[model samples]
Target: MKKKCISGLVMLLCVMLVSTSVLFAAGSKESGASNEVDKIKSRGVLNVGVKVDVPGFGYKDISTGANVGFETDLARQIAKVILGDASKVSFTPVTAKTRGPLLDTGELDIVIATFTVTEERKLSYEFSTIYYTDAVSLLVKKSGGYKSLKDLDGKTIGVAQSATTKAVLETEAKNQGITLKFSEYASYPELKVALDSGRIDSFSVDRAILMGYVEDSSEILPDKYSPQEYGAAMKKGNLALLSVVNSTIADLDASGELLAMKAKWGLDK
Candidate 1:
């Protein structure tokens, strides 16, 4: 009888150990599956990286002192989806040079700052469905009389550093057999200043961003050198988070909210 009791206790201990192992495995799977989305929901705030200077896309309005633009609208919509309130968002101003690194290090939950999706960028980060499409264009002083890309041959173009604009422009120039000079700035505001001050003959970037800065004295050239598709960016392998963003985009598209946003921001189509 003593031997039988001992054997029963040993079996009970084994069962308990197996049960604990299964529970731990289940808990880990749940945690891993919902890591990013669960964290954001728990925080009650969605942290978005956006541009404060680029007009119509993601600009901080001076009168209201609030971030306002097409991308801003999308970010707020995302906040509404994730947190059940559109106001629960913190917009972190990020430039072309900093946006990717910030997203990589978890400083930003999403980047909607006119982020262009490209094969090269895809290696480092994943992007949601294309939310908006833009084209690379030239913004020149009205007096410059630059009517065509060929006319700008040998002229200096100001572009945002670390942006795809530079590469796109270079490729276009080479394909057209036009020799050009490029001056790189860290931000769109700097490029605007350079173009305004006559330091650079033209400012090259996405037409969506250039439209925000165009004044009566400046005009965008008619030619679109390259096409750009803007998408929301996040760290790679976050399919849960990516799915959420994609669904938000799809909802916006289906509800015509995306087109409404573009109209509000003066984006063409």
Candidate 2:
């Protein structure tokens, strides 16, 4: 009888150990699944990716030495929603080529760098509701005498590398029966310099971005092409974070803050 009781006690101990281990494993998975938003809250800071060169959208103000643009404002607004304070945000300047990868690698909590939403990108990242709409257009020297897409035939246009603008321009050119040469630059500033130096006949990008570089000698084509909706982007599978972002954007729209931001950044025009 004594031997039997000792064996039963040992069996119970083994079962309890196994049950505890199983519970721990399950809890770890649940923790991992919801950790993104929780991590941000614990840190009390939101890391936002933005462009430093696009003037009205996300650029560094020379006077304040701080980023000031529509996207910048949106990032701050998101920080407010997440952390209860708009100032609890850090901005990282990212280029078109680097934005997606940085977001993937956890270097950024969210990206608001005029990132356009597309079907292809949806596979890799989650996008918030469309916050802004922009159209692709051309910027050329007024003296270049390029009136329309047809005039771009055999001319070189400068575009940022890894951007959708080049592909959009190619499609439009094909429809117009124009054959164009494209010069790729790493950033908008490089493309702007190429256009100014006459290395390229024109620079192509979102009209709102090109508007920042427009000068007395430069002109934006009157006709806009290829409308795109801009959204904030984050790593895929973060439903909680996405929900927060979508809700914030909805609130901004409902409260007319989005429209006010557009006007403040010169996008309302």
Candidate 3:
């Protein structure tokens, strides 16, 4: 009877051990999730992806080497609201081809470059409500006498390869029954050079970008171009992040910060 009692006690201890292990495992998972939440709350830093080249929309100032433009300013503002330190932002230069992949890989917390919102893009990413509005516009040398998109027919137009501009132009051309020779450049700077040297008669982008470039460069403005607005892009299912972004943007717009930013950036007519 003593031996039997010993065996029963041993079994009870084994059961208790297994039960305790299971409880600990469940607790660990909850703890991990809680830790993730805590990390975000504590870190207070936002990793942002922005274009290092697109002037007035996203670009590094040549003199200051500081990131400036509408998107850059907006990114700083969003970071201020979310992280409480606009200066706590880490900006990574993202090109059109790499922005999506970088965001998907979790390398970027947000992308605030001049990314356009589209239904197809929505499948992979979310977009805040239209933060800025824009229509396609042109950049022409003062001596070129080109005033609008209509002036580019049959002319070699410089465009950043793999951009929305080419398609927008093609669609507009088709609708207007016109033809244009497209000269593709790998980057915006190259396209700008091509336009200045007369290798292409015009360069196109959202009007705001064109105007910003013109405002800063005598080689490029009033006689050179015009602008429009574009929306902010974010990752899909990142509803928490998107919510914060939308709120910040709405606040900026309602308070006139958005309009004021554009005006300060030379996008004002």
State the TM-score for model 3.
0.75
State the C-alpha lDDT per candidate.
Answer: 0.90, 0.91, 0.74
lDDT of 3: 0.74
Candidate 2 wrong stretches, greater than 4 Å: 1-33
Clash pairs for candidate 2: none
- Candidate 3 at residue 210, lDDT? 64
Instruction: List the lowest-lDDT window of 10 residues for candidate 3.
Output: 217-226
For every model shown, what is its TM-score relative to the native structure? 0.88, 0.88, 0.75
lDDT (Cα, tens digit) per residue for candidate 2, span 1-269: 99999999999999999999999988876667468888999999999999999999999988889999999999999889889999999999999899999999999999999898999999999999999888999999999898987888999989888899989988988888889999999999898899999999999999999999999999998868888899999998777788899999999999998999999988998
Could you tell me how far off, in angstroms, the CA of residue 169 lies in candidate 2 after the best superposition?
Answer: 1.1
Show model 3 residue runs off by greater than 4 Å. Answer: 1-43, 215-229
Better lDDT candidate (2, 3): 2
Which residue pairs clash within candidate 1?
none
Residue 120, model 3: lDDT of 71
Tens-digit lDDT string for candidate 3 (1-269): 99999999999999999999999988886676445334545876777899888766788878998888778899899888866778878888887777888888878878887787766788888788877666667787767766666666798877766667777778778877889888888777777777767788887776665655563332332222223335666655666667778899899888988989978776555
| C-alpha root-mean-square deviation, candidate 1 | 5.6
